[model samples]
Target: MPKVIFHKHGQVFEDEVKPETNLVVRAGIKQFPYPNLRYECGMGKCSKCACKVLAGAEHLPPPNWKEKKQLGERIDQGFRLACQIWLTHDIELCQEEITA
Candidate 1:
């Protein structure tokens, strides 16, 4: 299993997850003990799942067409939709760091 680290509200939450786990699911599972994560849609439609790749961006799956379109102009800044990100390796993510 890989690990995901979420930084938000000036705090951090980490969780172990399978390789295929998306950010939305992992955030929800680990969010109970954290105050920063805000997950709205498990699917990729909502922008609430937006996060920044503080580190290990290469470990995540490449953005698909849907994610690219959803992220739109924000994609250039490393903003990724949580529901669209499938973890292939260890990663560190932060919502506040990326979201405008």
Candidate 2:
């Protein structure tokens, strides 16, 4: 299992998830990060699930086409589309809250 540390709105959420887990998919199923990990479309089209990788980035594979197209230069800043990443190692992420 991989440990996920999610930060948002100055709050932190930690959980252990199975390998090859997609945060967006887990959230959609009302899992640990649900109601906290803000997301819309499960696909990579929506950048709503974009988050900054604060740790364990080396364990993640290079961003896929969807992430590259959606995140662009932001990828260099460690921002990744949560929907595009499947976790296999511990990861720390921070998501900026969207204000209406």
Candidate with maximal lDDT: 2
Model 1 regions more than 4 Å off: 27-36, 97-100
Give a tens-digit lDDT track for model 1, residues 1-99: 877778887878887777777666745776432346677876777777788888888776678787787888777788888777777788888777443
Which parts of model 2 have CA positions greater than 4 angstroms off?
A: none
For model 2, the local distance difference test gives: 0.94
**lDDT values for all models:** 0.74, 0.94
**Window of ten residues with lowest summed lDDT in model 1:** 26-35
Model 1 residue 27 CA deviation in Å? 4.5
The local lDDT score (0 to 100) that residue 22 gets in candidate 1 is: 68
Query: What's the CA RMSD for each of the models?
Result: 2.8, 1.2
Cα RMSD of predicted structure 1: 2.8
Clashes of each: 0, 0
Q: What's the CA RMSD of model 2 in angstroms? A: 1.2
